[model samples]
Target: AEVPVNWCPELGTVLANEEVIDGKSERGGFPVYRRPMKQWMLKITAYADRLLEDLDMLDWPDNVKEMQRNWIGKSEGAEVDFQVADMPDAAIRVYTTRPDTLFGCTYVVLAPEHPLVASLTTPDQEAAVTAYVEAAASKSDLERTETKSKTGVPTGALAVNPVSGERVPIWVADYVLGGYGTGAIMAVPGHDVRDHEFALKYHLPIVQVIAAAGDDSWDIQQEAFTETADTVVVNSESDLVSLNGMSAPDAKEKITA
Candidate 1:
């Protein structure tokens, strides 16, 4: 949000405040130098109502509308915090549409850019973690995007599963991004895409808690099992009720409740 100012010494006069030349003086044909200056700022909030009105009349494509809807992502769910066993003061939190999958989470992943990644890494793995984080940072915004390769380094820290009281290893991975619902994520390989890839790469366990549409083949599932209306929750604890023949939204609410 910073503006640039140009000053020309040979002109003997200051250029207009809005003047922006490419490596040239606006007056007297002399070289201009960039100078930092403070100026009053205009508030864009004054046009908020006008902008909203204009958007209502604009012709936007369905894809753009879908993207906007996804961006808004106003989903109702619980934000559960799982404590890190090694780091008592720290916790890994994840927002899930199906809190019923809470017991099935076998690992926890923190985005490589997460602030806690540095401190959570053990002394022995610090060097490797640092290198991974630096490499991830150096990647261009496009290269660092979600579509890029899945790279990660184990943090040597473990998070306590809130429901099962089991300690799950914490990993710093690029597959998880800081801009998502949370910088950290509960790895449910049986039901999530990124987690499935990470689990395959690391040979981690993939437990199936939700049955797919047609087949119940967990071992042969080529991709993550998506939750749908006909999907059923299986292998859940006694306190967690089964969601057989229930809609995904209803099942999620019932399990979380």
Candidate 2:
């Protein structure tokens, strides 16, 4: 059956995402990337809610039912749109769970295969961006997930934050998967571990937006403070929006509303 298999161009074979390791073909150690050719999907995803409801009538263990529920993978988050700087008509959309940290976003990251990559890249960076994209095409989503080294190339383009109106640099990072939510993300270094690591490696600015009760003295350059429940917003005020001094939960409610 035709399926959306991980196609390894170098290996000349299609593989399941599980079959690839560290972005290479498991059999030949060649690079692999996702290619959506005509493929068969279970068609069961559409009935996930029905299956979840009917599981209650079955004689299955609670853990098994919970496992089934988890497998369905329903995620909740808000999709925020970022306008490309200098490209009045172009925008990059990203899904973020922490919309409250919008003020801290210092950079935007797109999957190497992101459709806007070509149009967004500046002429001076075209060669580098092209090379990075080609290299990243060889990496599987799992490889990108497993490798925490924070590899990326600057697209030489910028995106304007919708909330803060600040312009942030754009980078093409393999850690972002083309098939994932919007293939784009706002890099909030001070509140996200991965983003923090990436920012540190690249020397990008890390703005602290969430501060705990006693965290006013904490140095975010040393570490990212991600404790959501006990934190309050800080350094998040601007002409357009302001969540400064509000609790994290309250800020999220207001920003999302």
Candidate 3:
């Protein structure tokens, strides 16, 4: 299968997860980076559900069972499509656990290696984009996934927010990995920590579309993002839908319907 691995040029070997630390091989302290390679592997994902279920019935230590559960890493979400501006046939697909927050989307991010990036980037940004992608090629997956002062370059293209029909800019960012999900993400900075930090660094707009129940005055400007039980949808609307005044669950169903 084609997948990313921690590859070290100095040792000419692929290191295991533990063998790579801070983007270097432990033995030689040689720099390693994620590279796609055809490797013999097992597709254990097919048994993930069964494996998780069996843990509950096993007479194992509580901590061990929990560890196994974490390893399975199941995430439930919907795939949303954001079409490239003026190019309906070309699109960016993203998987998100928060489909109900569609209205809050302020921008879209594509992994540096996503297939569509090259075609979508404008001529004016070609040089900058190429340089950024090259620099990102040598970073480990862990370093890229952590959004510490998230870094990205403009593609000089935009995508249309599916729900609001708003035109949002597209960027090729290091924090998003091509091997994960759809290699693209509809960034809802108002409710997501990674997205929020990226937005703050890039000076992107952050608009709140959900609020604490009965507190219409809640302000996202104060960094009030809590996945609390008491919450309601707010400021989410379009010609085809209005999630305003609805709960997150209800809004998800209505919008996805």
Candidate 4:
């Protein structure tokens, strides 16, 4: 059986050394690459704890360790269910570090490539949706990275705020991805980076739910403000008050409560 492989046109033969020439093609000076090949694979389920221990003992910088810890993302938060407007039985759920953002969620977004997008998109927007999806697919992986411009198509579907009972528009955007924590996200533009960009691009409402310490000089027009210190939940419809002297995590709980 001939197995699929990554073949560099410039390279004459199949690669034998997994690591060579700064991890480039050994032949013809082509850029060698690693592509998924259907082959016998070893399951590392038995090495989970051992691998974790090895990582803990590594002589790495604090920032690197912190990044690993963040990637592991072992934390506690509420799983809030948001009801989809117009579609009674359908809903999009998201997990957030700050449930305090629930009231600030001006819009909800699914990855442009999300499966639900097709079902949720209105008939009038079908053509536009198809075009946006095509454009998103044509973008290179680097171009689809988070730093790229926030592009989206209005699904014409709305998600009801579980707390406020307000209907927020659902948008299918390339900035959100199926591989992320959730394929869908409730966009609290006031607090999130990507959401802020999307709101600015679409001229959506951006309410500042949380405030910074000292002087409130953070400018949303010039840049995204994500400094999470001395945050106070402003314009909250609920009884949530200014989260003074509370860390972001604790503040989220108090506000949600």
Estimated TM-score for each candidate: 0.68, 0.86, 0.91, 0.69
Local accuracy by lDDT, each model: 0.68, 0.85, 0.86, 0.68
The TM-score ranking, best first, is 3, 2, 4, 1
* Between candidates 2 and 4, the lDDT winner: 2
Worst 10 residues of 2 by lDDT: 1-10
Per-residue lDDT of 1-257 in model 4, one digit per residue for the tens? Answer: 12323344455444644422443554555754333245554445355456556777989997987787665555556667788877877888877777876777889888765667888899999999988876664332334553467678898888888866788898887666554556678888877777787899898877676667555666655555577766655556643255544556766777568
Off by over 4 Å in 2: 1-5, 8-13, 21-33, 36-70
Superposed Cα deviation of residue 153, candidate 2 (Å) = 0.7
Off by over 4 Å in 3: 21-24, 29-33
Could you give candidate 1's per-residue lDDT for residues 120-203 as a string of tens digits? 889999999988876554332234443445877888888888876778888987656665567778889888877788788888
Stretches of model 1 off by over 4 angstroms after superposition: 1-63, 146-148, 212-222, 238-251
Please report the candidate that would top TM-score against the real structure: 3
Native-referenced Cα lDDT, model 3? 0.86
True-vs-predicted CA distance for residue 2, candidate 3, Å: 2.2
Question: How high a TM-score does candidate 2 get?
Answer: 0.86
Once model 2 is optimally superposed onto the true structure by TM-score, how far is the C-alpha of residue 97 displaced, in angstroms?
0.8
